[model samples]
Target: MTSLFAQEIRLSKRHEDIVSQRLMLLQQMENKLGDQNKEKTPQMQRAETALQRNLSLLKDIEAAEKSLQTQNHPVPPPEVASLETLYWASVEEYIPKWEQFLLGRAPYPIGVENPNEAEATIQKEVRQ
Candidate 1:
């Protein structure tokens, strides 16, 4: 039997792609409408056709999603669930080192070179 979890993920990705494509088509149609002539050119005709197809696909995806939701699925065991939790936490913490290098910025533990500034902040906190 096919895994319901995998099927759900695939459907989610497909839905996102179709929605993005639909938005682009809408933008193209809007731009065509904004032109001074407002004539229905071949390009505009194709855009309208594609938009209709995208809408149809979105409807199909929604139907499949509703069917999927009705079915019951087994849950992962505790150890597996804990590991998955840790994995997602790491993903959240990850800041790409390559991106930081390209931006020429200080990496995470942004150092305080001025000891006096650090001391002053501590003293102010102690006073409060």
Candidate 2:
């Protein structure tokens, strides 16, 4: 099933698309007005006004989107976040070592400086 957040994202994308179309139209109008050598015409003034309004509206939409995101998916607690970090860290550290073992090569610890401790670890693994 689709999620509410996913639906909202689709809606946001639609709004952004419409905004982009309007922005392009506004730019075209501005360019047409720029080509005129006479004093500012009523059409030029109207185009400038519409452009300003659209810019403000784009800002409002962005602000509203950020507010919705913050309200719906707030930051996780520090402890929960730290636990996730540790889980990924362990996965990153062990996956290659296990892969090497599966391929029939003894996987040595990556950063062991003490030779005796490293030997003992290997011996324990062999005994197991």
By TM-score, the best candidate is 2
Stretches > 4 Å off in candidate 2 = 1-40, 98-128
lDDT of 2 at 30: 90
Candidate 1 global TM-score: 0.27
Name the 10 consecutive residues with the lowest summed lDDT in model 2. Answer: 119-128
What is the alpha-carbon lDDT for the whole of candidate 1? 0.71
Off by over 4 Å in 1: 36-128
**For candidate 2, what is the TM-score?**
0.45
